[model samples]
Target: MQLIFDTLTGNTRRFAHKVADLTGVEVVALADADPRAPYLLLTYTFGSGAVPESTAAFLGQHSHWLRGVVSSGSYHWGESFGRAGDVISAQYRVPYVARVNKSGNAEDVRRVADWLQTHAANAAD
Candidate 1:
């Protein structure tokens, strides 16, 4: 599966690429993505746990192929932190792979990598 990302401050981009480097998943920007296979979306949360408009637009076309979601947000947002992933996951009935702080840490990368390895393939079925 591909790793598609939408970013405002580049944290989601950085985190998506880090996950790509570890998992060998192809990474692409939302603007360039036309996913033919399953994919995991990584995006950023905006005001009051809202999903970015660009990401919402992308999902409008591509949610059918989505297997999971991850999102990045500032930790200070607390309850709203990375809530975009939760929103997308619930709406699309896909897994909420992670909610990362900023660009994320090694542990976050590892968890995502593990999920990609173990769960992403199953999603295709």
Candidate 2:
């Protein structure tokens, strides 16, 4: 498994680290990723926190799982973060778990770890 990000202020980077720590997954910046990895944790802040331009472009050009939260900061208040994730999930046939934190509280990271673990276990089964 791999955790990929196009972080600016390290908020996304910190979240990626937490997911790696929990899952023992390797971390790679989007630019250095292996396109063939079966599982990918794509993290970015977007929409009010919208997705980074590079990350969005990458998603448009490549097919991968986009795990973790999708909103910038207002996801909890009936925002469209999950909506954006749904579009990607449908297009890629990849499952997405959407989370939001106005305070950068690591909720999305934790949820991503949990989602990855579940997928890993299911794959083994």
Q: For each candidate, give its TM-score against the true structure.
A: 0.95, 0.68
Judging by TM-score against the true structure, name the best candidate.
1
Poorest 10 consecutive residues of model 2 by lDDT? 64-73
RMSD of model 1 against the true structure:
1.1
lDDT of each structure?
Answer: 0.91, 0.58
Quality of model 2 by C-alpha lDDT? 0.58
Instruction: Put down candidate 2 lDDT per residue, 1-125, tens digits, no spaces.
Output: 55675565665666666678877987787777655554454554555435567766877765544433333234554655435455555656766665444324567667776777766754422
**Model 2 vs truth, CA RMSD:** 3.6
